[model samples]
Target chain A: MSETDARPGYFGRFGGQFVPEALSGAITQLEEAWRDAEADPTFGLELDRLRSQYGGRPTPLYLAERLSEEAGLEVHLKREDLAHTGSHKLNNVVGQALLTTRMGKPRVIAETGAGQHGVATATAAALFGLECVVYMGAEDCRRQRLNVVRMQLLGAEVVPVESGTRTLKDAINEAMRDWVTNVDSTHYLIGSAMGPHPFPLIVRELQKVISVESKAQFAAQAGGLPDAVIACVGGGSNAIGSFAEFIDEPDVQLVGVEAAGEGIGTGRTAATITEGREAVLHGARSIALVDEDGQVKHAHSISAGLDYPGVGPEHAMLADSGRGRYVAATDREAIQGFRRLSELEGIIPALEPSHAIGWLLAHGRDELDAGATVILTVSGRGDKDVDEVVKVMTELGIAGDLGNEVVDADPREDPESDA
Target chain B: MSAVTDAFTRARDEGRAALVIYLPAGFPDMETSRACLEAAADSGADVLEVGFPFSDPMMDGPIIQAASQQALDHGYGVADDLDMCRSLTGEVDVPALVMTYVTIPDTRGFARFADEAAGAGLAGAILPDLPAGESDPWVREARRTGLDTVFLASSVSTDDRIDRIAEVSTGFVYAVGLMGVTGVKDVASDDSRTLVERIRSRTSTPVAVGLGVKTRQQAAEVASFADGVIVGSAVVQAASDGEPAGAAHRVADLVRELRAGVGSR
Candidate 1:
């Protein structure tokens, strides 16, 4: 992610132009367009204007004082939850949607797991008055019915994908199908930094705005960059988003937390980067938690948003290069952490963000730098996850015990050590 | 019989349904999936469409997707899948075709993939995702290696698309019976019957109806519409069942039943 010593547009061998020959022409054009777009002051100005007016950029950076006290770490929250349509997902969509409009494409197709992105893309399509088709897994449609309705209400066609694994990956498969079939008039609005080459890099590039702002906010409020940056990893947008900025700040420690479901040993974890090695899982060569036979294994998470079998290839390379440490947290811990923030800080962290807090709790903060700031991007609000968290809490027999735990917990009690 | 084409002709004359079972290269693993394909072939399957797993297979239904996911899980991706296709020629002479979309071919270079497919002892290649209009460039490139480029036709294709597809397609015209994804419920309707007749009149290329034809009853019933009843989802459903070989036997029995139906009708 660091631009210095950058290997001619490569992101640590994870980012390159590995497009199909048919797309190489388009890829080359996009590369030039993007390079020009990045260089042009007007492009940034217009993008920022749209981000403010349409996406409601610079959502908020709130101090989770009470929650940080409970976690025993100073957990400051970057409120991507306040973004339009309730998640950091909007950040990437708004950029791509605007770019699609700029590229003169009138139709957009997107793939969705939890439908957060489907709804977001639908919202963008509706705003721009472009035809939108969102491919959602039959399984995901059942689980996230509200998002299905939300997308439909926004005038996007929801294509229920009854294909492979019946989940996020299948939705992507369907979307890619639609793209190849309709590429003449449509642009595929990828939702994550997990697909083929340029995609992982592009999504990260669009998402870098988060870390760019978070850094300035932290410096302005807390006097300087945080000692550590934390974010949950699915396809690793927010983590990669936040990590991109501080990747070269040698003094800063970068930590990515993954969902361990019941436990890391249960084989039901979404800890791809922590548990995986170099392999392709969803197109991009990344750290994928594949089985011994090299197939993408089923990833389990209490949160549907975090249940992906792989991390973005860039994150895999980053984790592999020891640029950051990837860790895991169990379902119970994330749930407890979710409740801890709600009770102590009066902020309900999205399940994906709660995974970061989960890791913070499981690994006592003794490992963190003493009095060193740990900033966790609260990527979204917990509104979508409230019912599920309630179920998990009741199943853990901790429905009413959250109050006591928040008071007893200490996120920074142990302090993150340099080691 | 000339392998795959011969299987279709023989089935046509015998008034029996030709079951073309499709298995992605790695459904859990290449060897296991190859065995499953063998089980299908050994159980009297007339032809086989061994899928070359691409990272994305948009036209597939859930069953195939699950199979592909299993293949991915078993470390059978595009490269492994091509190897599996190559190994098929050594295992059985049952004219196997590798079914993959066009984008992957475009990525690996169509000519290169075609050469590989032929070298792997593959009979031909079917790229369902390629449009009839766009087939000229890539298919022309694909044909350089002597691998027949099979194009698909839909029930909804106009006379023009049908003619275009028929013109370039060498092996067989994959006639999609319905206007939907794979593995959907196929209730034989007047539209399906008409679509089959419409395609039959438009091209001399042998037409095979795929999609939604699952049960033996459906296969037997649908066989009346086209030269071959391409049973994909059902074969997959059976192959993925707990008892793969036993399920294949059931499929063979279904093919026999359909064959009887075609003979009588």
Candidate 2:
């Protein structure tokens, strides 16, 4: 069993197999297949070969001279943006696709919000020559039309879902429905490190490479570990990946930044850990944005990827246990960080990771020790988000003043409120 | 006499399977929904499994989902559903069961939710999303309040899982007919019969076959082998296919047909 797959699969009372009984048999089969894949040595050898030969392994850890000078501290960037699919989503998809093949299932289905995971899962499906169908909300299909077309071009069918809220949560519901109907021949390639049982454990193990590589690279480049490792939290795939290896090192703080949308306390944000309650969502028990009536609310974020109302269960446990700090960055501050990285380092980062950069530039700057090093996981490139950022800036009439604003920490992330 | 066990025992004594009709509470409107529940009992429905509409119904298909959305649009919440159950149980001498998602109880506090549901005169609760393994809190509270907790078995479930679900289940074990959501199908599959047999071997708990048992003939087919047959989407469809005032009439007619279907078995 994986470290997190504790019998009924809970991360300290967070994750469990909370799906319908129609899906119980399928989920159990998936859990068994995952265990088998973990034991087989060839699975590792094949994945390694694919990573090095096809996925461009060991994406460089670059020292940001300009950004470091601006902050007066040495800042290093783990360049996951340079991976084959331009995001860290490929790490989980590639691993899951391998498991699908081992299970001998000829088809895969997935649900995506920002379309990054859709494109990545489609890419792996194409490589494996499997039939793939992706469910995206009608609104997200309209917003991320380009990525929708990209998925179609990659030989995957893109189905637009028009149920509940018409967003990521709806897309997931549709995908789960489809999986239930076609459980015999299909595998649901869940994008994030969330969902029932083996998915959270499976996704975290697949994504742990980010922190593992960053640890070794930091030891080689800076001759010591960075004082802090930061990543953005949507469903918390990249954040969990970036923090899993450093969880035991108490001195090296693990920071997970969430999208504040307008602001955390403003009642319109995706800051799940900061402003959410324990609820069952998408077959997992985690912190979720819900109304007083127990209806899952629509989370607003400029970044579609970070617009999810619920997060991975492990992130909930980590935050609850005080091992990981969960914070938020407003849209305006994220745009400022987006502009700073592009102008200072010539790297246009994805909006999801820009939340992490936003936190580092604003409140995180004062928290780090003087001259201490900080490592940030730039989870994806900004090709999918460039137009959205420009539109927001132009609409606000703050074209050139985007980088002039600084954000402060919302007190909801304070540990005192946690009790 | 209003408990689920009494209903099942009566049906067994009569040499017929129990006819359980699943309807969403406050569908269309509260008055008509209460009328429908009474009509169901009057039309020989042995048990009432009233669905509490959830915004995100993961286990429901198009028909039930649409009915749930309609109920939600009519301003139905946990309190309204419980009040509907109280009113229905007070008026009718049948076991009124509440079918809901785990989020309702999880959000409202599991023990408190179960206790309040019991206080509302509900004989039992059916949480489609909660498996036997993760049901400690709700099960404890439900047992404490004398409310039966029903668990589900599916075609994909192993013998061990069936045994696990049957042990904690008090009302009955729901045996899913197929590996799909709650919807209408042309016929009840043989998998459900085999699953019911599997559950029977594991425990002495009554087994109710549900999911895709839509038409009268399908209900009859399922009733031949199981202790109870549940028809959800079919009755909901009949109620929603006409004007709101006429929903109870349509439900009463469908309940008569389903009751006949069970009696024929």
Candidate 3:
């Protein structure tokens, strides 16, 4: 991040403070506290200690030899699924929880989609002894019942929001309202790198540890950098984290796989970068699915986590600058990815990152050079998604390949301009 | 400009705070909403806040959010609501400001939105989502067309932040009375008093306190220390709950009481 990006908060016209008036002071204070923490070495040392002791740092970078041999390429997986919360969401929440304590706020509020971030936040608040409240869509609560139970076990109050589309977007709106009302005693632990100023930066910095660790691990194992790094982009937290360290490496291709619920350009997708326009959603100016009159539309995806209508502003900047390439994977394709990883590699991948795996399987072998090395960040484990995935598979009647075209072979090439 | 600035001046001269009332556009129907705005003005509301209903009102409390949802369900589009604004501002004598989210103006180009607002005879706008830092584009366009761009001062704002808001805010500095959304409260907090005082010390702009100012007592309490007392959710509740014939009248009655509350102070 540049100095200008750190202070005034603009990622090439994508990031800004577009929240309600009541949140401005809290955001400013958070930015200052975050900056101070960044400057303090003690903060980093303590966070590292917690990361290692409590949250389990330095997850493995395993070479998928069988899968690579099948694809005729070198393939590696960053096992974020092995994180404490069974997802990579633990990275940002732990950082924010520490910041909440530093700010002297006793309560933390967050919004969740698939309940992975909610579970991570609840676990952090339990560890920190901070009062935790999570807002989740009522529909999501029904979909991810086990994770809901996990959150309650962590001693966090889960609020099922019934307003709007009864989904992640509504949960986020409800959480913001809670923050505006109780900002004096509470800190909003935003689950993604999508919201207003300081948040996109704060989350990126905290989650950047993923890319930092993976870079070192890959270098140690492969003796060189991978030609491509890919991850699924919901609000683009894990994708940004995976791409952050290798962003400036021009030779390294950064691919972000979005959820095309039905199909791209079908008006039934969460592929914001691929089929959306520039508009303000939540607290940042980013590409969002909006109607002609500027009202935001509800996003659809088989995976609750990727059912968000918008992407992080930095991802917008990356796509705009041609530093990152974004693609979409349909629900069938993601399921195929999930089955492939579980069957071939004995890893039940989360539905969210299955989009990435889907993209790689459908295109990686043909697109990448013969000797090219590829790294895919497995953002979460699939335990939370088992029932939902099974239900989807059963409904679609997919005991085997249904002759679905997972890849079009014709790449969007430029997501920024296409939208 | 005359309606808003003159209302403040008149209120100051009369030894009371101005009573600002909020009602969403096209709640139930366009005609009823227009009649409600006119009735509010006739019942002694010093200024009127015309809410352009949005699909997601993230900053609003349940009451206001419900009202907005009802209005949106009534099929109130952005441009059509502005037409309502034009009709009400043209008919009513008091200044009417549009209170909405940022996505409204952002959907229509800022300059075009400003021009249409000015053409509609609106006094100004208050976008709760468009804070001071990121408001340059909208503010510049609004100012270009001589529209008062009101900015809000939260209860948690620093003195420097209050000063910054007071300096840029035109029609009035909207000082949030509490740390909550637009809703009803039986009592007023001391934080609003402190915020208004801080704002008063920094700039000459009129300061209006909103957020949770519901009842007559609460209105009077805020009016004792502030230049304007804004009532939103209560008025919206009146429109939402009352019968068709009594809805506008109910809003007018509450505005009258709030007006009396300001006058009593």
Candidate 4:
């Protein structure tokens, strides 16, 4: 079903404002501001200018010939990895920062997992001259240490949340607590196409630049739409952005790859659509990894960005309505995809998008025609993941090998050779 | 009238605010929490709010959140909450209500939840996350089961929203004492008086001020305007201060002090 057919603030019985009473006024104000901003031409113009000049919009759509050959398809990459802050997170934050200014809020608060959104939010806050505070899981802080430093360097105070599970969901809980305590002067700059009503809608519209540009660019470059568009799903911001424009075109397939840490049935996966049931988390009712008592379960993933128990409510709707297909990639497969892209395409992708690449390599040939074109979104760069990847690779005994060959002997011929 | 309404009316006849105590079911442990609730009822609690612990409690403060986490860690579920409420209603003279996020009941099926709650002798329910705008299905089932539905109205809620909330609310209109979650604040905000007055003007449903009413002085001050005084975190903290028996003693003492404070008005 189209979004227009859904009730106000609802997407097929999924989305609603299930927040505390204290936040009712603020959410209503945000909805109003969003409506006004959507109607005003100046808002669109300003957002466009920021996207082009500040955020580096219209990111390239390049053909990865070697990777395409490997997949037995015409594989094109939507280069969101080249966007400012090294991800598509900049698009949503820049727009929300403008909305913060428009709503006359002087401060902004955000929650981060892998720190990509945190870095992007910190950058936008610095550019917009707003006071910024980001809540990140303490575990995530240790896992993605460089992004923490990046956020600090951009003048954002990072609060390490030491709560339940101490991951993305807890970070969100802390951020929501902070927002409830300080809603009058602060705007919650949510980084995903999730949360209550206006958040999912607003985030989707803000990040829609991905598919909007790709749709036009592909027509100009290849003269037709791609047969399938694929992207990794966490809270589903980039994937929804990559799928929003193509949702109506029945011929254009939409695919979202989730992180299956070990396997879907192993109880240590983040593949919400595959293994989770319908439940309420954060602020929306979506498919989530929940136990029999309706309590959300902890989700594990090698990619910190996809280490969440819930997905965006709209994605749940899409999945249920058969408008989009959801899949999973194991940590080992993602690592292989990470290495394969670096070797063949000279691009080191963040582990989040490596799930999409991994799925394509494993199932693209079986799922599509031989010459069908596919557009896969590389959502972020791997500069922040190099250390973690190296540690995991070393643990697996495949540190220096391009293939899975384990070299038992030390590469150094002599212990003191370097000295 | 429902048992909740009767309690408020009886408190009005006594010229005092109804004293409501909130504690999560199975907190610390099942036996200790039950003992604490019994002590509260024996000491002079007019109503009991039995909290059903949820995995993600967005509307709770640290003390209650920690208590809830402890309860969940101990493997408490909706069945445990129902059993506690059933026992409390059978043993105590005070009315009891189940407080939880809406998802618990929504997942369990609203009609089934309401029927089971009524069967357990619960007088009402307060779902903090289910606003009046989205409470139709739950309210319909609750009304079918003769259960009162309590909706919260904050100091920031608009007059029109307060009207809607008051119109739909059955037991009482929960007037949030501050623009924050459930916690003990140093002082109750003056905005609650205005909120209570607004609800009073719109509907005659008893208005209870919660979320920051911690001390006797604060309870007395709030009791001057609101028809009911609700306290949660401080009582939970008291229950956690000692062994089960000692904790019961502490809870009884605190409830007596709060009861006196509410009556002082």
Best by lDDT: 4
Please give, for residues A1-419, the per-residue lDDT of candidate 2 as tens digits. 22344445888768988987778878888889988888999999888888878899778889999988877678899999999989998999999999999899999999998999999999999999999999999988887888999999999999998887788888898899889888999999999999998899999999999999999999999977789898999999999999988988878988899999998788889899999998999899989997665778889888889888999999988987788899999998899889899989999999999888887888765877777788899999998887688778877787765434543566787989878
lDDT for A139 (candidate 3): 97
| Clash pairs (backbone) in predicted model 2 | none
Best by DockQ: 3
Error of 3 at A345 (Å): 0.7
| lDDT for B152 (candidate 2) | 85
Which ranges of candidate 1 are over 4 A from the true structure?
A1-10, A15-33, A401-419, B1-49, B52-265
Model 4 segments more than 4 A misplaced: A397-419
Compute the lDDT for candidate 4: 0.91
- The full ranking of all candidates by TM-score, starting with the best, is 4, 2, 3, 1
Deviating ranges (above 4 Å) for candidate 3:
A2-7, A365-367, A399-419, B184-187
The lDDT of each candidate is: 0.72, 0.88, 0.88, 0.91
In model 3, the Cα lDDT at residue B165 comes to 78
Per-model TM against the reference: 0.68, 0.94, 0.94, 0.96
**Alpha carbon deviation, residue A235, candidate 1 (Å):** 0.4
Top candidate, metric TM-score: 4
- Two-chain complex of model 3, DockQ on C-alpha atoms against the true structure: 0.74
Interface RMSD of each: 8.7, 1.1, 1.2, 1.2
Please provide, for model 3 over A1-419, each residue's C-alpha lDDT reduced to its tens digit, 9 standing for 90 to 100.
63144337888878888887778779988999999999999899988998888878888999999878766778899999998999999999999999999999999999999999999999999999999999999999999999999999999999999998899999999999899888889999999999998899999999999999999999999988899998999999999999999998888999999999988877889999998888888999888887755777889999999999989999988887788999899998899899899989999999999998887788777777885798999999999888888778878887444333454645576677676
Each candidate: fraction of true contacts kept? 0.08, 0.65, 0.76, 0.55
Clashes of each: 22, 0, 0, 0
| TM-score of model number 1 | 0.68
